[model samples]
Every structure is written in C-alpha cells, then in structure tokens.
Target: MEILVCVKRVPDNEESEIEVNADGSDIQRDDLVCSTNEWDNYAVEEAIELVDEHGGNVTVVTVGDDESEEVLRRGMAMGANNGLLLMDDAFECSDGKGIATILKAAVEKGNYDLIMTGAQSDTGAGQVGGMLAAMLDYPYASLVNSVEVIDDKKLKVGREIEGGNQEMNEIDLPCVLSIQTGINEPRYVTIRGIRKVSSVEIPIQVASDLDISGDSVGAASARVKKIDYFVPELGAGAEMLEGATEEIVEKLIEMLKAKGGLK
Candidate 1:
C-alpha cells in the first residue's frame, strides 16, 4: 500500500498578522512566518499510520519554490519514507487546476495505491484533491476522517456528514482521499526526528520533468484569479443590538418586525 500524500507550506496565522498586499492581489508574504499546512500534517500522519499497519511506504510531495522544501522535510520527519518537491518558475501563480495538473503528472510517475491531500488549504479552497482525482480518473473522497483496510483492492473510509453523523463507504484502491483534521492527532516532529531525516535526499521535479507545459500553468493560464483582496463594506441592513440578553432579544424582535423579517 504505497501512499502519496500531498503537503503544503502555508502562513502561520497565529505567528504572523495576515494582511492583503498593497496591490490587493494576495496576502503579504514577506516577513510572514510559514510552516506546513495543518491539515496536510494530519494527512501525512494518516498515511504513515496506514502504512505502519498495512505494510507499505508513505511519500510526501509538495509543489512550491525551493523554500517549500521545509514542509517536505517536516513530513519526512513525521515518518514519511520519502519527500518530493515540485518546483519550477512556470508553476508560479497557478490556480487550483494548475496545481492538480502538476500533481497528476507526479502521480502518473509513481505506483501509488493511495493518494492523500489536506481537506482544505489555509486559502480555504478545497478544490485540488477532487480536481486531481478527476484528472487522474481515480475515485475520490473528501473530508475523510477514518480509514479501514477492507482488502488490498478496497478500503472503508469514513466521512463526517451533516448533523455530526459519520458516513462510511467502501472505496477502491488507487483512490484519492482529502483527509480531514481530527482524523488523528499528528505525532510531534521532535528535533531528533528532524535531524535523523536531515540528510535524506529529497528529489526535485520541475515542469519539464513532470511533462507540464508552461502554457498550461502559471499566472497566464489561470482561469480564476484574485484581482483584488479587500474587506466588504458594512451593509446598511446590519444592526448591533447591544443590551442585556432580554433587552437585546426585545430589540431584535422590534427590528425584525420593522424589517418584515418576522411574522
């Protein structure tokens, strides 16, 4: 059961103040503290645990600049057997689909029994896992919270549905799963663990190495883009009813009556 887990480096919201850049295109990255995406850590941990029980190897992959190597190293420190970095100048400003395209190429190059990705990125977009599964023509499940081995060809995955219910389904092998946090507590990567994997060689794959064409990715190819990033102005309809709980409830009733929101 060889697993490929996709990890990402993201801003540490707790460690840095996230602000929109002056151009309103993206977040202010310079001086921002960054680390492995929290959800990706859980994904990598899940893969390692699965491999531990089922007998296989876990490999972590990420697509970013050289600095992004840190996240791969962290994943390796957490017990992944190998780390892979996909970097290329042409991969800059890639949208979700572009990232998925790059991941698809890497997946094609590996004989993985399972593929895992974080349920969502800090950017709040959970599109890549589904898109990558679609591009690879593999079955995919998102928000997966539990995994059980049914056989070499099948796996029982549990997902948390609405109303806090758990839904279980049997998915075929060679599938992709977007792992949800709380699936398990990720093991801590101690200094000793980091040092142990410090000298391990992590391979790098570029756009050419992955057979990804420049025109198909990067800023020029992005169909969806952030042209601006600004907070929406407060609407006139919004009201703050300040008082004791009872008074506030009465005030809310009056406002609702005035607005025809309540019968």
Candidate 2:
C-alpha cells in the first residue's frame, strides 16, 4: 500500500502576519518564513503511523516554491520514505481548483492507494482537499480526527462535527481524507532522521510535465469565485465588573439574560 500525504509550508503561527495588498486581492509579503502547516504535520504523522503498522512506503508531496521544499524535508525527517515537490510559477496564483488539479495529476502519476491532506490551509481558501477529491473521483472525508485501517482496503475514521460531536464512518481505501490537527500529537523530527535523509534527492514535478493547465482548472474556470477579501474592523473591548462573588454572579446572569445568552 503506497500512501501519499500532501503537506504544505506556511508561516509559523507565532511569527505570522498578514499585510494587506493595495488591491486587497492578496497579502503583501515582506519577511515571511516558512514552516510546515500545523495540520499537515499531523497528516504526515498519521501517514507515518500507517506505514509503520502496515508494511508500506509513505511519500510526502507538496506544491509550492522552492522554499516549500522545507516541508517535504520535514516530512522525510519524520518517517516518510520519499518526497515529491511540485514546484512551478503558474501554481503561485492558483485557487482551490487549480491547486487540486495539480495535486490530482501528481497523485495519478503515482497511483497511490490513499491520499491525505490537512483539512484546510492556513492561507487562502480551505477548499483544496475537497476539490482534489472531486477531481480524482475519490470518496472524501473531512475534519478527520482519527483513522484506523480495518484491512487492506478499508478505514475506520472519526471526524468532528459542529457542537463538539464526532461522526465515525467506515470508508473504503483509495479515498481522500482532509485530516484535522488534533488527530495526533505530531512527533518532532529527530536529529538522526534529519541527517539520514539530508542528502536524499527530492523528486521535482512540473506542471508542463503533468500536461495540466490554468485553462483546465484555474479560478477563472472554477465553480466558486472570491469576489473580495477584507479585514473586518476590530470593535470594542469588554467592560470590567468588580464586585463580591454574589454580586458578580448576579451581574453575569443579568447580562446573559439581556443578551439572550440564557433561557
């Protein structure tokens, strides 16, 4: 069973900042450093676990600029057997469909048994995973918190829905899963693993090689469009209510009732 895990490089949340562009169509980048997208790291961890349990090779793939190779390397250091980098200038402005189209092409070339990705990216739209599933004509499950291989061709997955409820489903293999972050506590790359794969070659894939194009799956041809991007104005702060415990409880209850927060 050959599994392909799609990962991404994003700005570390702690040092992340969004600088609005003049057209508000994109963010202005000045000093952005790349790290693995938080949820994608969990997906890599899950893939590694599957490979460890069942004898199989795990390959980590990503679409981004050369700097994004860091994500693939990070995955290799975590236990992935190989890395594939889909790097192209045309992919820079791609929306969800375009991104998925590229990924679909890459995965098809490998004919992977299962494909996994983060439920959403930290940047742009979070629709890539579902769009990729549609392109590949694969059954998809999103926000998956846990996954267990029932057999060679089946999976038992737990997904979180609204209101803190979980939905469990038995899905067939050769499916796409958009994994949630809390699925596992991703292990950090060990110094030994890093050094071992440090000199390993990473396969680079090109859009032209895939024979896919912007006209085929670009935003212009997308079923959805982003009309605008705006940062909502930050509003007011809270008022402090200082009093005894009883007084505070009464005030909180009154406020809640006034706001219809209580029945």
Candidate 3:
C-alpha cells in the first residue's frame, strides 16, 4: 500500500543550545545547526520496509525552509520513491497544531493507504501525531513498536506502554501510526543511493498553495504559553547511615516509607 511518512528538520541537539529569542518567547535558531529529527528516521525506515514487502511506494514529506530538503534527501536515499518539501515563511513559526493541520492537508492531497510519523518531534510540543490523525479523521495508534499485515486490508500493531505493558491493536488501511523508538533499526544511506537523490529536485508546496491559514498557527496562535525557562538546582549530597546489613536495610525501608516511596 502507498504510505506517506512525515519527517522534520530541527536543530541538532548535539550542536545546539536552547536560548530564548530576542522576543523572549520561543527558542532561537539563528546560531543553531540543523539536522533531521532523529526519531523520524525510524518512520521512514518503517515505510520503506512496508512498501518493499507490499508492492507500493513511500513518499516522505517535511515542512520547513529549503534546507529541509537535506533531510528529505536522506529519506529518499533510504528507499523512499520520492519526497515533498512543504515550505513557506509561515511554516517557520508553526506550533504543533499548525504543523498537524498542514500535514492533514498534505495527506489529503495524496492517495495514501497509510501515514506514519515519529511519536514526537524533538523540538516543538509532542502533540502533532495524534492531532494530525484527528484532523484527518483517521484511526491512530501511538508508540507503536511492531506492525504486521493481518490481512490484505488490515494491520495488527503493538504499542509500548508504561510498566512493561504492551497494547496490541488492529486497524484497517488508511490509518495513522506514531512509531516509537526501538521499533526497528533504521538503515544508513549508501554512497550510491545518496548520489542518486542528491541533485533530484523534489516538489514544493506553500501555505497559499494548500489554502492554509497562517493566523491559525505559531506562538501567536498557541493555546499554551511558556512563562519562562530555568534549570532546577540540585540538592546537597545524599545522607549515609553507617551500620550493619540488617540495620541499614531497616533504616532504608523506614526512610523510603517515610518519603512515601512505597505506598
């Protein structure tokens, strides 16, 4: 089945520091180096594997400036048939909801059997995947660790849960899945594949092109506001009680119970 894998380019955490912009609002990227959001690599890989097993194509899409093409090319080299870069000045300031809205519109424009995205983006708030699914009116499963073809038109999925629990679900074609990390090991781009898509000019779409509204997105439109950011201070060194094994164990238990560690 045809699949659309959504990806994003953000500041490389390794090379960037979080600093408020001049407006004292969102983080600034003027001095930060960009890279593909790492979690999305798994989404791209999952799409490639799905298309390889079933006879179909994988299309990777990202909303960003022209530089986003770098990450899109990386997806192409990993086995996506083509890529779409949805870029616009408005998209530069998009919040999670706005990004989801754009993605919903883009997916609607394509004839896709399934859509895939990472569980969350490294930058913005982690709400786009579920929000996009809702906007598209498609069934969604998040934190998916495994996916299998249950039938020609159905898929079985396993989602990771807290406390070592796993939730299994089944959904028909034309659904959305937010893939979790450790779902599968993503493949690296080979030199030959990299060369092939390096010069290929992928298509571009803008806000007006999609008839999307800029006023509905970005910090200006955000429902949640960041008051401020400050690192929490660490406390003093741990207290140690010198005693025999049994005494120490009892003391530890008493301390834990007193702190409500064991309820």
Candidate 4:
C-alpha cells in the first residue's frame, strides 16, 4: 500500500497571541512560532506505522511557502519515504476549499492507496480531508481514531462519535481518512534524522504544474472571506458564593430564577 499524508505548518497558538493583521485578511504571523499542526503529526505517525506493518511507502505533502518544508522534513525524520512541497506565490491567501483543490490536484499526480490528514487544523477549520475526498470522488471517514488494514484493497476504521462512542466501518482503498488526536503518540524527530533529510531534496510543485491556473487559487478562489477580526472584550468575572453547601445551592437557584434561567 502506498500512503499519502497531508500536513500543514501552523502557528503555535499556545505560545503566541493571535492578532489580526491590519489588512483584516489574515492574522499577524511575523512574531508567531510556526510548527507542524499537532493533529497532522498523528496522521504522519499512523501512516508510517501502517507502512511499517504492511510493507509500503509513506509520502508526506504540504502546501505553503519555504517554511512549509520544515513540516515535511519533520515527517521524513519520523520515517516518511519522501516529501512533496506545494509551494507557489499563487497559493497565498487560499481558503480551505482552495487548498483542498490544490491537494486533490497533487494527489492525482501520484499513485496512492490511502490518504490521511488531521481531523482539523489548528485553525479549527476541519474541512480539508472531506473536501479533498469529495474532489477526488473517493470514500472518506472523519475523526478516525483507528485504522486496520483488512486486505490490500480494504480497510476497517473506527470513527470517533459523540459520548466517546466509536463507529467502525470497512472502506475500500484509495480513500481519505481524517485522523483524530490521541490515536497514537507521535515520535520526535532526532537530530541525526533531521540532518539526513535536510540533505534529501524535496521537490516543489507550482500551481501550473498541477494543471491549475494561478488565478484559480488563493483568495481569488476562496469560497469564504474574513470580514473582520478583533479580540473579544473580556466579560465580567465570576462571582463566588460564600455559605454552606445548601445555602449556596439555594442562592444559585434564586439567582437562576431571577434571571429566568429556571422554572
């Protein structure tokens, strides 16, 4: 089986404050620390493990500027066979749909038996995998926590559902799976592996190379647009209730009733 894993380089939200740029088109990224999307790391690890078990190759792909290569190299260090960087000035300002379109174009250029991606990006726009699957007209499952290869052309997957339930199903090969976090612990990239992949050239693909018009990507092709961005004003602080447990409960009920929150 040949697996293709799509990864993204995203800002480390935990370590940086997100401020909208003056243009209102995107966030201010100049001071942000960028790293591979956390969930994508799990996808990469799962792909590598699958290949390790089934005897196949795993390729990692990403779409972004030069910095995006770092995420691909990280994947290679974690045992991916090769990396593909879809870099083009035309790809800037692309929305999720535009990205999925480009990824579909890239996937078409390869012979992949399985495709995996994070259930959602750091941006929380969980759209890429499903959109890419739709574009490719392939079977897809989202929020997948486990994947079992049933045969050369079939796979049984466990999808995470509400209330911690898992829905298992069998799907044919050449399908896309949106992996969820906690599926597996991602391995760290060692210094030696990093140096090794650094010398391995990563091929770049432009929009035209994928048979896509430059104008048909980026903001021009985006299905959604950001109208505004601003930090939400901090709301009122919580009020602490002081009394016995029963008294506190009674006071809470009274407050709720006064606010018309209860019968």
Candidates arranged by TM-score, highest first: 1, 4, 2, 3
* Overall lDDT per candidate, in order of appearance: 0.94, 0.86, 0.86, 0.92
Pairwise lDDT winner, candidates 1 and 3: 1
Candidate 3's residue-wise lDDT over 1-263, tens digit each? 88999998877878888676777655787878887787789999988998888879999999888788999999999999989999887776667788888898899888999999998887546688899989988999999999997776899999999998999999988899998888889998999999999889899998887888887765567665667654445557667766999999999899989999976
Per-residue error for 178 in candidate 3, Å, reads 0.3
State in Å the error of residue 193, model 1: 0.8
Q: List per-candidate RMSD values in Å.
A: 3.7, 4.2, 5.5, 4.6
Model 3 gets an lDDT of 0.86
Per-model TM-score on C-alpha atoms: 0.90, 0.84, 0.83, 0.87
lDDT of 1 by residue, 134-156 (tens): 99999999999999999999999
Lowest-lDDT window of 10 residues in candidate 4? 229-238
lDDT of 4 by residue, 158-230 (tens): 9999997989999998899999999998988888888889889999999888998877789888878877777
**Backbone clash count for every predicted candidate, in the order shown:** 0, 0, 0, 0
Off by over 4 Å in 2: 21-25, 217-230, 235-263
> How much is 1 displaced in model 1, in angstroms?
0.9
